[model samples]
Target: MFDIVKQWKWYDWAMLLLRMVACISLILTFIELRDQFTLALWVVVLWELAAFSVPWLCLLLNHKAYWVTETVISGGISIYLTSIFPAAYLSFIVPAFLMAANSSGIAYRWTGPVTIVLIPLLIKLYAPSTNLILMMVHVALAFAFGFAFHLLMVNHRQNEIIRTQNTVLEQYLSQVERVTLLEERERLSKELHDTMGHTYTAVIMGLESLRSTAADAAAQHKLSDLLELTRTSLDEIRGYLHELDSPQEQLPLVQSLRQAAEEFGRNAGVKVGLRVLGDEYQISRQAKMTFYRCLQESLTNSVRHGHATRMDVLLQFELQQTRLEIQDNGRGTARIQEGFGLSAMKERASRLQGQVSIHSDSEEGTVVTCSLPRALKPADDVIKLMLVDNEPFVRDSLGMILESERDFEVVGRAEHGLDAVNMCEELQPHLILMDLEMPVMDGITATQSIKQRWPSIKVVILTTFEQKGKAVQAMRSGADGYLLKTMEPRELAEHIRIVIRGGTLMDPSISAKLFEGDASDFLEEKTVIAPLDTSAPESSPLRVLYDLTPREMEILQHLSKGMRYKSIAMKLYLSDGTVRNYASALYAKMGVRNREEAIEAANKAGLI
Candidate 1:
């Protein structure tokens, strides 16, 4: 009740004040007419009281019935007051009738017009001496003013709603930008740690070896100085890495939660209590980060929207799962319209195979519960890889580099594509790095064969060539990733990890080449077409003249080139479902029933 009052606008206060004045005036009028009070006069007083009090009762209960009931009662009171003292009480009754006509919540559409017409007629009927024409003019004026005021209030409400939507959109966009920037930062930090850290370690090892081989004191002293400087530089890089870490990564999940709660309490002047239950266990970095972000978002919502004064946080570690609950003593809402904050919280939790649930009420406040699984993959589970290349030096170098990383194990090495395929049945590696040009069988055919036989196995084409056509063909053959031999060894390992995590990777230069041209130009270059058949039907030219969008034309070209829907979707950066929808629409437009018919139509029209 207090929350509703707090949300009232200025006009609400003004209307309330006007209602108060009308009630006071009616009370004084009754007191003055007590000596001449009749049954009609007593009835008028009771009706006025009921009419005024009903609106308040309806508002508190949030009843939809208030609109019709209030309109009827207000109309009745207006007629009674006017009939009792036509000229004397015109001011009070006019406002009452207008208020009913301009009510924001009028369930019955006919109520406003009925109130307008009936009140003037009653005035003329009760006071026969009153001028009918003048009263009719007054009714018209009252309706005009009432309708204008209603429109103004409607416009104001719509503007408020738009403003609120804009605010939410802005917040969501800002959060996306921040998330993108953070991800880029994390990537750079990792790249630096992997590449530069290894390089530094290699340099230190070389300097020590050289120093031991030195026979002169001067050379030894200089080498020692250089070694000291290199060590200091490595220490500085470590410091920068620490600074680049996100706040959530700086401490354990529990300590981070406590610190965040304490800091928020101190700044927002809200009381926050945190409790832990059961023995804590180690969680993945991603899960820890998700938990931290959810807590921060919940705290912001409780204070910003719920206007909470006190919050209670509970962390429980179960045998199979970890749970976090947040409760707030705030003015909770009956309906929860999830805005960006709540939606983002859910998204974060879901990414880590977790779930978030919220329950809210006007009296009991809001409770948010987030649960994540405790059974996460161990850190030492290495990715079993198979190296495939005809060149011995290439295979050996890649094997040496990958073996240096604890997370990668080269389970098998093959000299060619056919050998790799034969080895896969025995090795059953998690990932196979294959070269494009190999003896007996090429990489693309090998990849397609392996994928057809064992779809679970991932294949990445690692080659020296940067040809766009080869990359497209490799992807069409179900290659998980494509990269050049020029990529840093550490970066290659990271890319392998990415592929293992169900993400696709492409060399940036090749990606640019694949997506460079406009739709028509790209289709013309990538799609092959046979010379126009002079022997075919002449009506085919008419079929080719049918109107088609650039996207539809592009899709048709792809279909004619023997590319599957999944391959088209990957090339176009669209979902499989979206590609299917486009194909359906294209079929409808082109008067075709399926992919085969569409391709035949395009070929006859010389579109491919």
Candidate 2:
């Protein structure tokens, strides 16, 4: 592509060559004229050389500059030459071509008249008196024919150049289109993984926090079962997002994550390891990577936050599904909030129609497990998983969601939070998922009691209350994660596999909101930027209501109940935009002009 443009550098020479063609015919005429006049051959060569050389003067001027002055000089010289070399009738063709090629349709009409006068003058000089009239007719025919050829050649070459240029432009545009599609896919993938991912983490945290218990050995056994389901949910999320990232970023989910982990470990001066347990395991690209990214977050939590010294990765495959397990010997948090690690893992698993589970405790440290279907998880014989959720709806929803995933086994379900936690310990299950608000006991209170005795168990949360303030509280209480009930159930299964590997889930949107005061996240700081919105407050009152998302409007209603932007971003999972583009869009739709007027308009339209 580059070479084509480079080689065509001398764009003007093509036109110059056309003029040369005209000159060549004239040169022939001059030679014949010398014979008719009985002149020296040197004189003939000299006259013709001067005629051909004259056009080079046009090259000294810009494309259209000094045209009148150049034409006068050229025509006068041609007339003088014609008087000298009337077989210059051939010579006259030179100027004839110049005018035909350079001038447009009507003005170029003169070339015929000009050729007629010059051709006869030359014929009179070259032909015998008896033959003069007949020879003159031949000269007229030659001039007319030459002028017609020139007309076609000039326009044909012009179209050829245009066609070549269009071809090059089309290729460039095609490449740009390809790049744009790739970028859009990447952006969407990032958005999904970051935003909804956190909601899952919060939900997981709610469930994981309740794993601990002080009941009898059977109750302890039940708690262990809950942990198994919790750990596998993340792998499912990675498998789902893998599809979104591929064909665009051109990076496989597993490979990109493995490389990222190696880089992080190297950069942090920590030893992070990746292990594949299922020899013939295959999961969707998203499932593989979600587990991988979850590993990064879990290890990061271990080293930077968990303050652990070692981490382990376990991958298992079955004929129908695959399972991932990550664990570490570190002080485990009971509650997992909307942190980046668990959140992103949950999102990826959801996309793959998988599930995630998280388990943590002071004794056994922290464990994250993820499971995926062979269809969605990418490997036949992936691994077996025990399901735990008190609500039949939640359990059935999870089972149906994970039905497409291979290598995963539902094993059994626990009807109560306490029963789920008790079953986890007794079964010593690979993964566990517990609902926070279950009968007999809650997930958070149970996780604390279970982790005190057995730290190796992995538990994931699938709960409703995990959505808000309860999430942070659940984490502190002893849960490894807090994943939402609203997640596509597959995500809950995938994260469980990753948690089994001792990995962590990272949700991007949650991370963005974690630090409320950082300048780097300018648009994210609603309170800081909201004060700036004070600029329009004096001028635009009552319309500010349109700026909020429906969730934010709910938050606004809460603010009407007295809530704030921070609460709204938390509630809706939005990064506070400086100039709310959505608010502007809402304005036009709601028939208000700006944020202030929008509130009034919404009221008028009964939207409030």
- Say what the RMSD of model 2 is: 20.7
State the C-alpha lDDT per candidate.
Answer: 0.72, 0.53
Model 1 / residue 32 / CA error / Å: 1.7
Evaluated against the true structure, the overall lDDT of model 1 is: 0.72
Q: Write the residue-wise lDDT of candidate 1 on 1-608 in tens digits.
A: 77777877776666677767877787688778866544566676777787777865675555455555555676556555556666642543445444543465653255455545665676677767666667656655665666666667778889976765565445445445655676677788877878777787678767977998999999999999999998899878877876887866757779989987887776666789999988877776667777877787787788768878789998888765778888899898879898877897888777655667776778767878777766332344567899999988688777756765646799999988899899999998889999999999999999999999988888999998898889878887889889999998877987886677555688999878866857554443333211123333334443333545456677877888889989998998654544565676678767889999988877767666
TM-score versus the correct structure, for each prediction: 0.48, 0.34
Instruction: Give Cα distance to truth, residue 302, candidate 2, Å.
Output: 50
Model 2 TM: 0.34
